[model samples]
Target chain A: MPSSSSVPFDYSADGFAVRDDVTSIHRVSWEKIARAGSHWTGPQRVEIARQARAARAARNDPPWSRDALPGAEGRLPETAVEAARTIGADAHRIDRAWAESMIEALGDAAYVELGSIVVTVSALDAFGEALGRGHEPLPDAIEDGTPDGARLDAATDIGAYIPMADPFPGPNVGRALSLVPEANTLFFSNVMAMYGGPSGSFFDLKWDGPLSRPQAELLAARVSALNECFY
Target chain B: MPAGEQIVGFGEAVVRGSEDLPAAREALRQALGEAGFLEACGIAGIFNGLVRNADFSGIPLDDAALHSSEDFRDKLGLNDFSGAKNSDLSRADASQAGEGLFPHKGQ
Candidate 1:
């Protein structure tokens, strides 16, 4: 992990332009969150306002301890919310323990734990197919199946899982486990390749990383660049 | 790093879907750029895919013994709107009016 003293992150001139755009988007989102004032206290929203910049300063892969704060008697993971930033952290990471704690924090707040099925079977071949190479850590065994499609949010054109439906556990995890929820967990297990784990070690300081308002902005920009997301 | 370890909670939320869809989507656009927007949708679409499987497998709604949140479940639209209700469907109107046709998708 880079020491807290590392004052600069070498984003070249081009990187600056990209960073600026990401920042502007976050600003807009935070502003919106503040105005909304739902599911969070005004002070809570202020903390979320800091997530984008803090996550960025940590290079988008911040550690857990520095990233989360206690809420409602439990340490809620970064809300990482957008839409004007007063409610939750727009961009942040949540560990498994943290994931559990987040769900735990909900405390009868209308949340569901989607269960995840862990196929202890060898995933080396699967990883090879995904990356065309044999890697030590492999992706989980999850795929888009027929039955899974039936559950799409059909009633609404939005066709997305509603946030109100959130804090949902991994289908394969605990009570949330169903065959398809299991597959969903496997999918979550697989996409880590794109998010930068080992490659992002410099920032995954766990609890030792930066978690302040400015760091959130920096994290948001780095991810926006990597994902090429410009909303 | 474990695959689960990489995405973090929101990372999975990226695929599993976010606490707030449009806002999260918009936020991705801010952080990730246009592709990020698409990625959020793609990630979320996968979760939508699960709804059928979950309902089919006779998957029971999570028992309180597990994860519990009254506000989380029933209030699906609240979190995304920052607690505002999504009773209005302007996007649907535009689509029905054949307006812009999935502004997120490429022309």
Candidate 2:
């Protein structure tokens, strides 16, 4: 039950910490999610991320399909590949039924792990593309041991596919990633750095940055609208 | 807010996986310089993931956020969004939008 304020800007748990020099918060977050998960190995997680990137790239291509790219033949589980692609390319379509089946097939932890990986990679790649820089190279996989398999709190139905832990009085985005603490922390650290540095200056509409706070909020709101995200 | 409007178009292009994203990027760069354009994209990219995570988790809006954002959300018709409805947590039919992934019973 660590309060949101207690999670340091450079927080790392269970042998997972991003390098401080990685000033690019997205890259830092990318490194964290690319690491091994509770069920998937680092390589497996990386592969899933790769597939998610490919899925996002292929989104504008004709004949929409959620298929993994050709090179990923048998490199990861089919369900895992599908989950990554779906979460990356069309996450708004993920209803409870889709999630329940994914959990039933992949186990709750793995499913959560896969969704986290997909969204992280998708976000990074999207940033790269928007910046007119190609996707960042996947960091070398760190061979961490098996996932610690720690479910810190009993999940209750939160109208999502899987039950969620108790709500913290923070942004729903943070709560969204709480089921897996590593993912939650990794994602938020990157967000905090990218948006406001250590000060969490997200709501300061006139703050200094390459883009003004209003400009940043504009981009954020538009993306959220496009994704149909309510929180 | 013309710049913001252009950014909305650029952000939508990036989020929707549009082929015109390069053009959109160029437009934003022209208006906001290279650094500003890059920052705009970076913010949009971060939200792409954040929004998805929130939608998937179905976490409700914080009471403060909901209260403060009521006017804006209403004006934007954000409440009409499927994800917004799902976040209510009290709606019995919230989870019934689509069929559950499991087809067979008790496999």
Candidate 3:
């Protein structure tokens, strides 16, 4: 058996240093998204992250049969709250019409940011849930920082709902999260570390790991199916 | 195809959280042992987030990806998914609609 010290995990790519306080991969990744992103304020980001968790918790509750549910008060914007609930409970329902409506209400940038928060929180929470550890608390929001608004990549319209930044030989997940670079960085960094490194070696038919690539792919495919995700 | 039954059952249990989870987990444990079984759960948890990211964003497969995965997607009936069917909206439309909503001040 390998000791804890022998395990390889790095977060330098996302500007995080190894720390004794940051024990789990999920906790550190949660800290990354708690910061202000390209569109939302830090407080707003944190609030949305909270709502994402709340939505996940409420997922198994009886469906709000009526069009309006009482006591839906939240710190995040109404549209953002709805987006979080939809994403957490059932992302498959996020069709073009719903996305368009959200963009109209929340603006393209904010909508993108909300989507980023939902995915980030869901990933972390799901990991914790699978391990029976539950969710880690949200870190303090980094206030007084403005969005960098960096659009360095010349994205191409590749039949997606949004333009995709060039990923070259990389998977569609990179391009999918490219609209918000900070989100992309946080998500991919965690994914790369947990699954395998960025070399894409883990995605092949045969690979060196405790789990074969086919077995890994099968788990991925099954989860995607359960989520009703076609990508 | 060697361990298809156990693998598929394990995957389903991981996603569904069904009552069969313990049995499925044990089957996978018997096949891949502890580390591999745990890794499978981790991968499943990862996709639980990843699939949402793609679906919520309405991201479509690039041309090459679309072409290559056609057979696999069809065989798996993935094309019938709601996200795939609803992903026809153009990015140009979204961008044009959001014009002036967020000033690209930093650009």
Best by DockQ: 2
* Full ranking by lDDT: 2, 3, 1
Which portions of model 2 miss their true places by more than 4 Å?
A: A1-27, A61-68, A142-144, A154-157, A165-167, A197-207, B65-80, B89-107
For B1-107, candidate 2 gives per-residue lDDT tens digits of 64876788899888776878888878887888766765676588778778767766656665445555655676787887766755553333423433332223243
Scored on chain A only, each candidate's TM-score is 0.26, 0.78, 0.77
In what order do the candidates fall by TM-score, top score first?
2, 3, 1
Per-residue lDDT of candidate 2, residues A1-231 (tens digit): 111332332223322232343245655665665577666787888888888777767765542553446556776888887788777766766676777787888877677777778777777677656665556667667776676676547766665566566644444455566677676666666565556533445433235666666677778888888877777
TM-score of 3: 0.76
Question: In candidate 1 chain B, where is summed lDDT lowest over 10 consecutive residues?
Answer: B82-91
Better of 1 and 3 by lDDT: 3
Clashes of 2: 3
Tell how far residue B56 is off in model 3, in angstroms.
0.8
- Proportion of native contacts found in each model? 0.01, 0.69, 0.63
Query: What lDDT score goes with residue B79 in model 1?
Result: 22
RMSD value for candidate 1: 20.9
A214, model 1: CA deviation in Å?
A: 33
Ranking 1 against 2 by DockQ, winner: 2
Writing each residue's lDDT as its tens digit, candidate 3 over B1-107 gives 55567778876765665768778767876887656665665676677778888888787654445554645676788778888764442322322332232122234
Please give the CA lDDT of all the candidate structures: 0.27, 0.66, 0.65
